[model samples]
Target: MSLYTFAKNLVAVILFPVFRIKIIGKENIPKEGPVIICSNHTSNFDPPVVGITSPRDIYFMAKGELFEKRFLGKLLLKIHAFPVKRGMKDRNALRRGLEILEEGYTLGLFPEGTRSKTGELGRPLAGAGFFALRSKATIVPCAIIGPYQPGKRLKVVYGKPMDMEKLRNSKASAQEAADAIMEEIKFLKENHSP
Candidate 1:
C-alpha cells in the first residue's frame, strides 16, 4: 500500500473512534481528475479528519512549523504534504499546489490561512480561488463541524463542486471566488443535521 493510504488508515484506526467521525455528502467527490478541497479551519484535527474521510488522496500545504523537526519533515514529505511559510506569500508552495492539480491530483486547503479559535468561519485567503482559476480544477467546498470532545460526534460535509467556469467567465477576483466557497461552507455547517 502507498504511504498515504497506510498513514490514513492508521490515523483512522486511532482517531475515528475517539472522535466518532461522521462523514456526509461524500458522494459529491468526483472519482477522478484534478480537484481542490477547500474548508474552514478550527481544530488541529481538521486536516486529518478531512484526509481520512476523503475518497481521494489529498496533497496538503501545512505550516512550516510542523516541519521544523527533521524526522517529521521527511515523513510529511513522503506522505504528500509540503510546508508553507504562513503570514507571508510563499511562491514555491503555491507553485507546488498548482502542479499537483495540473497532474490531476487532489489538493486540500484551508483558505482562512489559519484556524479560527472561536469556531466561526472567517474570511478566506485568495489561494483557493487562485488555484481553481489557474489550474481549472474542480473546487469542492467542505465544512467540518466539531467541538472535538472525545466520544462526541464530529462531522464533515462535502458540498458539490463550485461552478468554476461561471466564476472564470464572470472574471471573479481570487478573493471573490474564495468568499463564494466559504459561504457554501457556512451554509453546510448551519444546515447539517445529526
Candidate 2:
C-alpha cells in the first residue's frame, strides 16, 4: 500500500479506541469517481476525524504554511495532502485539486477556509462550490462534531451526494451553491442522532 493509504488507515486505527465515533449516512459517498468532501472547520482534529471516517482515500488541501516544516511537509505530501495558500483564490492549488479530481480521486475541502475558534460555522468560501461546478464532481456534505475530546464520541454525518443540477449549468452563482452546501451541513449536524 502507498504511504497515504497506510497513514490514513493507521490514523483510523489509532482513533478507533480513544474516540467513540458515531458515523451516519456513510453510504452517501460515491463508490467510485471523483468527489468533493466538504465540511466545517472547528478544530485541528477535524481533518483527521473526517479522513478517518471516510472509507475512501481523500486528498486534502493543507495550508501552505504547514509545508514550511520540511519533515512535516514531506509527511503531509505522502499522506495525499497538497498545500494551498490561505485567504486567497490560489489558482495553482485549485488546478491541482481539479487535476486530482480528473484522475478520479476524492478531494477533501473546507469551504469555511479556516478553523472556527468560536465553534460556529464561519462564512463559506466559494472555492469548493467553484470546483464542484467546474469539475462536475459529486459534492458530499459532511458534518463533524465533538472532536479533540478523546473521551467523548466524535460524530460525523455525511449527507446525500448533491447533484447540483442548477450549479452544473453555471446558472447559479458560486456563492449561492456554497451557501446551499453549508446549509445542508448545518442541517445534518443539528439533526444527527445522539
Candidate 3:
C-alpha cells in the first residue's frame, strides 16, 4: 500500500474510535472518477478525517505555508498534499489540481480556503468551484460538524454529488457556484444525522 494510505488507515484506527467519528452518506462517493470533495474548513484535522472516512483515496490542496516547513512539508507531500497560495491566484497550484483531476484522482479542497478559528462556517472562496467547473468534475459536498476536539464525538456527512453538468452549462459566477456548494454542506449539517 502507498505510504499515505497506510498512514491514514493507521491514524484512523487509532483516532476514529477515540473520537467516535460518525460517517454518513458514505455510499454517495463515486466508486471511481475525477471528483472534488468540497467542505467547510474548521480545523487542520479535517483533511485526515475526510481521508480516513472516504471510501477512496483522496489528495488535498493544503495552504502553501504548510509546505514551507522542512519536516512537515516532506511529510505532507508523502501523504498526497500539495500546497496552494491562499489570498491570491497560484497558477502552479491550479495546474497541479487540474492535473490531479485529469488523472482521475479525487481532489479534496475546503471552499472556505482557510480554517475557521472559531469553528464557524465562513464565507467560501471560489477556488473549489473554479477547479470543479474547469475540470467538469463531480462536486461532493461534505459537512464536518463541530470543532475538532479530540475524544469528542464529531460528525461528517457527505452529501450526494451536485449536478456539475448543469452548473457548468449555466452562466453562473464562481462565487455563485461556491455558494451553492456551501448551501449543500449547510443543508447536510442541519438535516442529516451521522
Top model by TM-score, which number? Answer: 1
For model 3, state the Cα shift of residue 103 in Å: 0.5
lDDT of 2: 0.87
lDDT for predicted candidate 1 compared with the true structure? 0.91
Error of 2 at 92 (Å): 0.6
lDDT of 1 at 194: 50
- List ranges where model 3 is wrong by over 4 Å: none
Q: Candidate 1 lDDT, tens digit per residue, 45-92? A: 888999999999999998899899999999999899999998888999
- The full ranking of all candidates by TM-score, starting with the best, is 1, 2, 3
- lDDT of candidate 3 vs native? 0.86
Tens digits of per-residue lDDT for model 3, 38-121:
987787788989999998889898889988989999999899999988778999999999999999989998898888888767
Model 2, span 7-123: residue lDDT tens: 778988888778888888899999899999999888887888888889888999999999999999999999889999987789989999999999998999899988999878888
Candidate 1: the clashing residue pairs are: none
Ranking by lDDT: 1, 2, 3
Q: TM-scores, in order shown? A: 0.96, 0.94, 0.93
Candidate 2, run of 10 with poorest lDDT: 166-175
Ten-residue region with minimum lDDT total, candidate 3: 185-194
